[model samples]
Target: MKTLRAFITMVALVVVGYLAWNGYIEPEPDGDSTAKPTATAAPPVKPAKGVTVTSFRQASRLLKVIPEDRQAYLRSYFGKGWIDADKDCRDTRQEVLARDSLVPVSKGCRIYLGKWLSYYDNKTWTKSFQVQIDHLVPLAEAWDSGAYQWTKATRIRFANDLKEKRGLVPTTTSLNYDKLADDPQWYIPKVNKCKYIASWIAVKARWSMTVDQREKDAIDRVMKGCPDRKLTITRAKIGLLPFAAGTGTSNRNVTIDSIVYSGRSEKIILRNTGSSPAKLIGWVVRDEIGYGQYRMPKTVIPAGGTLTILSSEGRKRLDAAGNPVQHANWGDVWNNSGDTATLIDGKRKVADICRYTGDNSGKARC
Candidate 1:
């Protein structure tokens, strides 16, 4: 009986110690659910870091002025698909449409039939189909400029960025096609040219994508008329995990528990080993070879709960709150033979990672 009681006491002491340790390190939760384990919520994303150029000339100088390799471009490398960030059936195209629409857009899971004015040509449309979401920096151009060396996660982050409308905009289909993959030297918008050039420079400088001498020279020539035009680009804001924006410690207990890849597909399990719920908004799970990449939605992982991400749609999955979130379909991301799974936090910090190679059973514990 003494031995039994001693063992029970030891177990209780260990559990208490763990909770105390986590309570000290992790953000303390306050009365509010969103509060950090300590009552402060993590701050929502802000342009706290990166270069802030007040004028167009300064913004232009921020870019790595160099010649692009201009390699044979493959559109698929950058993965030009939109994401349903709000769980609305509509992808990024519809989101942009809704944002740009002057009229009330339909609010349905699979919808967004609305009106949009394409500033590229100063034309307006009543139907969403008439407008195209134009990347201020064309994907092909971005790839050549420097994106070719980026990982799939980086590519997806660039393509599906809904944080700011500066990078992507709604435009008429004809004009979008006309400007396809052409740099400023070859093509500059006829209307709203200053705004277009400013946005273009903003995108290039924000992504830290290089500019060839010709591209830089062209921008210099175009901006001569508007030399002091103001432009602001927010870089490193892509990984914004929504928070209350006050005093609180960042939760560092969330980590990858394991990576399971079958012969055909892949899934990663993220576990939060903290005392409080871990808000994983803006976090990213990606494989090294650009096959599977998932930027987490505005979701929370209960202290002890686990969330699984499949490369493609598998079964109906539920988050910690029992809410169903539509994870993006990354077609065949893992190498199956060998790959590395990395969990990157909103601050662009690698919280945890797991590597697996030649695992016939296809499960790697981190």
Candidate 2:
């Protein structure tokens, strides 16, 4: 019994010693416990307001043209005095660099891209080869703007004359290529149309050009985000569209999502994909069966929206007056002669329905 008691006492002493050492002699937390760390997130990517070709307008304030003969005479007499070859007035390249660049460069009258940034692809390149000098008013386009009526001398003067300082702009080579020969009313950079319209206006004004109502309507769609019809194209005035809560945005608050297309055959449908309510504006349709591809507007859809598959065509569609027709939905087979409808958002297309097919026969798809 005495030995057992001694053993218990020794054990108790050991336990007490161990507890004391653990409680008082511990290592520090390396300050990690005391400090709170912050989260590092990527900066927001704000939707480029007027980031499109429209920004070019702010710098373009001149209009009217000097007669080509007078300009040539000035060039001949001055001999690089009044008119400098490729150095006279602002060429499209210099003007664009001055307008589009974040950091612009110039050597006397010539302007070069200090850094090549492609707005269409959201890409940044180091060399000028990646970029191109785009003509806001293409040569063919210049013809439409009244250049075709002019003499060759006048055309040449207009083509390269810096005095009018109307055409030529440096942009991403790809973008320029894609936009070549297309009208401003038809093709505009999806990212910043307001900018495109303004730049378009600037070129038109400089070259004494005019726009029809249809073209004006397209421009209005983009300008809707601006404070008014008369919007100033600048970096600061671009505002944000209200998206759904928790949709998540970058530092610039541009939606991380995009609206896409889906369907097969000429009789097709469109759908809204983003979390927000997209405005269904227009569409593009092509049918090999005599119905060549066409661009037209859906009467009821809004800009920047989507179109649901409310109905179809190939399957014996209906008319506007709720009537039935023998050959309603198969529009491509009967009219256009194709079997595909590729609906492009923000584009226009034509839809056909017999007056007696669906609810309303002889009624076209609005």
Candidate 3:
């Protein structure tokens, strides 16, 4: 009987120890023991960089099909003349002069003495009048391509686009007149041929403008000689033009109006709902992963104006009335899903915030 009691005690102790080990040391099951395993979320994908011409052959292949529309070209269709689109009290021509002059501007919106390098003919000038603001792509060429079908507002915007660096250039007046309404078939100095062609391609592509057969052939021929040439085109959209009146503190209110996080063609729209113009010199747009900082040269937002920051790769979508939407280039800004965009002003104040999940279908939700 003693041996049987001892053996039973030993067995009980072993059973108790085993139970304690499982109860205290081992991991406990979830509330529902039969619950399925949770899935891990996949990593986000990065957007592709903007379209770049790797080679002349590639550029030739990518050229748009020649549009057969022989639209009537008229200067008035674009705009009455150079207007003060930026509302800086200086007209577009004066603004270009002020920006391109090597010397400091002397008078109000006038550059009496300055050095300007005209790339078209390898000439440099000191007199401001000697240099004419030449549109990289002429207005008539734009009409022949696709501008004829555009709304009046869109044409006006294209005609007086001071936002884009390549849109208008400071070249010798003689060169500007000689190359009037001519395509790439015209002569460009040997040194500037490559860049000239590239700029031409960039402007056409940015405006969604087409090329004629002759124009395409000319580009192809020029590019064939330049095998290693590469060109990247970036464009800025024009914001709303503020009215002359109400130049007060109330007009200085600027906000992050909208954001489009769709794939490569991401865009952020900023609006100045105030009565006075708001300067966005050191403004920043940040998403979860990356951010695009604005370094606008003349960073003034007119009252009731909207400034759109767009990605380089997005398709140029138009409004219902067929007016070309203006946008600035902000490459690969937002993620595909679960992203937050914050707009910070020069003073480091949060101007606006937009948060969304999943795809936005290229529309701004915030």
- Per-residue lDDT of model 2, residues 1-366, tens digit only: 999999999998788788777895444456676655667998966656533232433333323333211110112211222123454576545555555556656655655447756654566655556787566666655554444234445555555534332245546777888887676567888775655666666656654544555555565566567443342322211111122111212211111121112223323333333344443222333333323333222222223332323122432333454222121122233122212333333322132212112222222232
Ranking by TM-score: 1, 3, 2
Q: What is the lDDT of residue 185 in candidate 3?
A: 68
**Prediction-by-prediction clash tally:** 11, 53, 8
| Candidate ordering by lDDT (highest first) | 1, 3, 2
List, residue by residue over 1-366, the lDDT tens digit for candidate 3.
999999999999888789878885444367777766677988855434553434545555555877534532458768899898767678888888888877777667655678888888879899888989999899988877867546568789898887666789999998888888887866555567877887788777767677888788788777767756555554424232121112212223777677766755677777778776666554556666543543222255666776766756333454454322444455666665667877765544576778887764766567
Q: What is the C-alpha lDDT of each candidate?
A: 0.73, 0.43, 0.68
**What lDDT score goes with residue 79 in model 2?**
24
Who is ahead in lDDT, 1 or 2?
1
State TM-scores per candidate: 0.51, 0.34, 0.49
Q: What is candidate 2's TM-score against the reference?
A: 0.34
Q: What is the lDDT of candidate 1?
A: 0.73
- Which candidate achieves the best lDDT against the true structure? 1
> Which number leads on TM-score?
1
